[model samples]
Target: MRLQAEDGDEQAAIRAELEARAVAGTLQLDAILALSPAAPSSSEFDFLSALGPVQRQQALRRLLALLRNEEGLHVGDASRLADVSSPNFYRLRQLWRGRAKSGLGFLSGYAGRPTRQPRGVGALGTLGKLAAENSAFELADRSIRGLSKLIQEEQSARIPAYTLDAAARHLRQNARNMPDVLAARYGFRILIDYCAVSLVASGSDGSLKLVEIAWVIEETTQLILAARPVLDVGGCVGQQRATRAARWYIGRCGLDVPGPPAAWIKAVVPDPVSPLDRHHVDRMVSVAGEEHVATTGARRFGRLVTDVIGPILGRIKIIPRATLSENTSAANVRAFGRDILDHQSIRARVAQSVIAHNRPIIDMLRDSRLPLLDAGDRTGTMTSTLNDLLLRKG
Candidate 1:
């Protein structure tokens, strides 16, 4: 009993001294870490070492705590402590995890992006790379690329990126703007009515041979706004394909959208570009001329364009479905022709052709515009074209 009291009193005194030091700011960052017991850690701190010892220690402590799931640590706080954006911080963490457990692991990998142009290096490389730099500018004013080109030619050093990004992203746009600009003269929406073009591959393995393209193009501007590839066919595949294409450009191109709570069939237009056959084309066109769009025998397959995707889509009157000779808009004619005939070539064909068609318009916007087919209301629903946009019909 006497020995136990003496030991307890000794432990209390030691703890008091430790607490006093902690209160006086003498605690080492290496102590009390959430990580596995340290085994002689290296002094290295990787890219963060540039933050200097004081800042780095603070960041490292917070990071280890956050990883430990300590009481109040959070992702945002962790990122701030590391003095990096959330994305960059995640990238750094991933790099760290792939290597040794030593703190010196930060001494390597993921050199930061270069801040300035490398003297004689070209202003840009591929469209994919260009898109990474400025998706918004690619989404807007086609002239932006021309401007970039001119700038590169005159002075190799390009303008600051944030300035350009802000200017492009802030451009005013709405569901009604496209109609006011492109369709005011025509007084109606122009939709691309067509089908799949079998891409001729050299090797001919027979997989992904038929590439159906559903794309949205801004007519007057000759801009293929958003495009997604549909590698398959039949049933409601076109519906999803069409809806995805529209969803990308709908709001961006001044057409508001979504579909498929219950898409009521209105018409089944044949692939004007490559119809299945003469008889099939004749039959479909004849049926399309009827009083109401037919939905007969539609049960076996998936949603039709008229139902799931077309209604929102059928309003892009920037181009006309009329004969190319009669279609006055050059942008419309270019897009229609590109869709019908230009998707050929053995190597780098589709991407290159698409790039040729829509160079300035970079990666497509991915915000949700339409609900997936039959996502809501089992009985189904319909939509109406409003100001070159589609609204759910009440």
Candidate 2:
């Protein structure tokens, strides 16, 4: 009975020693919890929990090294506490230092290759160069497969389709090889024209309605000044609408249109032979001048309109889709006009679109070394005369 009791006590002591060794080797959850109340619920904790025992041990050892560094514990003491060799402790310290230098990128799971020489970096570069060159020539043609084929044939490179597609999109959106001669030459003096876009509103009950869009462009700068939507009850825009639009544009821009002697405003319109059209133009000529208001034949005017405004308007997503449709009802038309086609709403959208389109032009103009035209100074005398007329009328 005495020998049996002694054996039982020896077994208990052995079990206690095993438990102490286990506790010494393992990370203290209570200590971690005391340090950070939210640690148990954090993503780092979850990641650690998801890892296998061996990986978990490695990660915990590194974490212990980091904590020891933070607490200003001695390296040798920290190594002993983590049950790691001095070499491993120094390596973990280096990893912690790397984390501090590279930010959270050091934790990213992309261990295949560095970004500078990624798995398909050569193929991606080849695709990007081809895409940029092609995008310059064909602004609208962006086919990823076609670009991949071209790169494969031209450079003997085999790039992944998704990689090529991503590269193509990046090139197409960012490439700016187009010449900015207009922006370089003309700062802001521009020409204005109106185009009637036929739309099938859901409320129009299958009937087509005309919405007039005014194209204000700087001829020399080739920069789109504005694409304003005119709310015209009449299907066609006449002299009154044109004059009003011009006046609104001038007022909004805070421009001083110099009188007859100096041509502050230069406009090219379709020649009008009819007495009524002539009368309308004569009034405008009085405001601008006969020299500034040149008239061209229908063919020439049509070509000019197409060349100047087609490309600019083609880039807009809303303009092209404004087509006739049988699904629209009269009530829908009224609602659309009130909600989407209202003067204020349309103007606001136009202003936003134009601002985006003009950014490059503005940048080019800012960087341009060309001499600017002194339109205001050249036409000061005419401006004074017009001011007098306004005062007299008032």
Candidate 3:
């Protein structure tokens, strides 16, 4: 039967291409670049056509190169295949290394460095050589110095003056006062709003930005300040009492309190640029202190709880035997609850009394993930928007 142009035909074409490539021992990229006689029309599929034939071919070649070199290609081999010098190759390699370590393997493979491919004077080789010559750290330091000079010039300051030092001091002072000011200005409502915004922003941007985290931190710190009155009045005398009272009334009931610090999240949360895994969450929980994590779903809650108290158990380094489940420990659970509930702000947030906060403005940048995405997307997240400044082939 003749296939429908919209779905069936496209599926058939794709399948045929896959089968043919499988038979020909070509990569999927190679098969696609080969171009089918029954290729979809531009009107029917604008996205694929937008790539154009030349671009498709180039992309396909890069893909194949990555597949061949990813595993076997070392620093030297990549430069040779990219047709770049050793120095240039080093830079690309570092960029790739940074990407891979950050959980962005998809980007590394596509940009350069595929599995087991040997590098020896290819299209990307020459670029690699150039990159090795330019170091990212050196580039960042120079850029900072240049910015300092420019700011000084704009202010009509002395030639030898350093403005960065002053800026740093000012920022630090502001950060110190930020917690109290937040409580006075926004209150609990703004704190919740900020957390919601942070979640959305973090997902949209691929990774959380400094500003997003800062908002959360600021809101959270303020929330903590607001809760002081309740704590001061003997609302709960000791840590255990606070935990029990909070658990009885607030836990998961949506109480709203100040959330964990940005520093806590930054230290705990794994690199988002990389692929997600259960282990990453576990590691985060270990650092986060189980008391601080709020349980939502059942298994997810258990995991979060374990993550909170896991470190204190001293069993973090070792997996428990199946038999240990029978010898349950109530003390551990009580301790976890008490430890978390003791902190008024933390308890409020966990109990849903207040919104979980993000990083403060000053500490916002300590764990930003934009640079990884920029490097992956070919859009320069760090360095500069100076792609046009650099010499390149069309």
Candidate 3 wrong stretches, greater than 4 Å: 1-67, 70-77, 80-85, 98-101, 105-394
Total colliding residue pairs, candidate 1 = 11
Candidate 1 TM-score, C-alpha based: 0.24
Per lDDT, the best of the predicted structures is 2
Where does model 2 exceed 4 Å of error?
1-190, 198-208, 233-278, 283-302, 312-340, 370-394
Ranking by lDDT: 2, 1, 3
Model 3 worst lDDT window (10 residues): 192-201
Q: Report the lDDT tens digits of candidate 2 across residue range 175-243.
A: 322343332223334454544332222223443343445455554444554455545432123434443
Better of 1 and 2 by lDDT: 2
| For model 2, the run of ten residues with the poorest summed lDDT | 105-114
lDDT of each: 0.34, 0.42, 0.28
Question: Model 1, 138-216: lDDT tens per residue?
Answer: 3333443353453344444565653332222222121122333322311122232333322321223432233334443
| lDDT per residue (tens digit) for residues 286-311 in model 3 | 54445543322322211211221121
Q: How far does residue 302 in candidate 1 sit from its true spot (Å)? A: 22
Weakest 10 consecutive residues, lDDT, candidate 1? 306-315
Query: Per-prediction RMSD in angstroms?
Result: 19.2, 20.8, 25.0
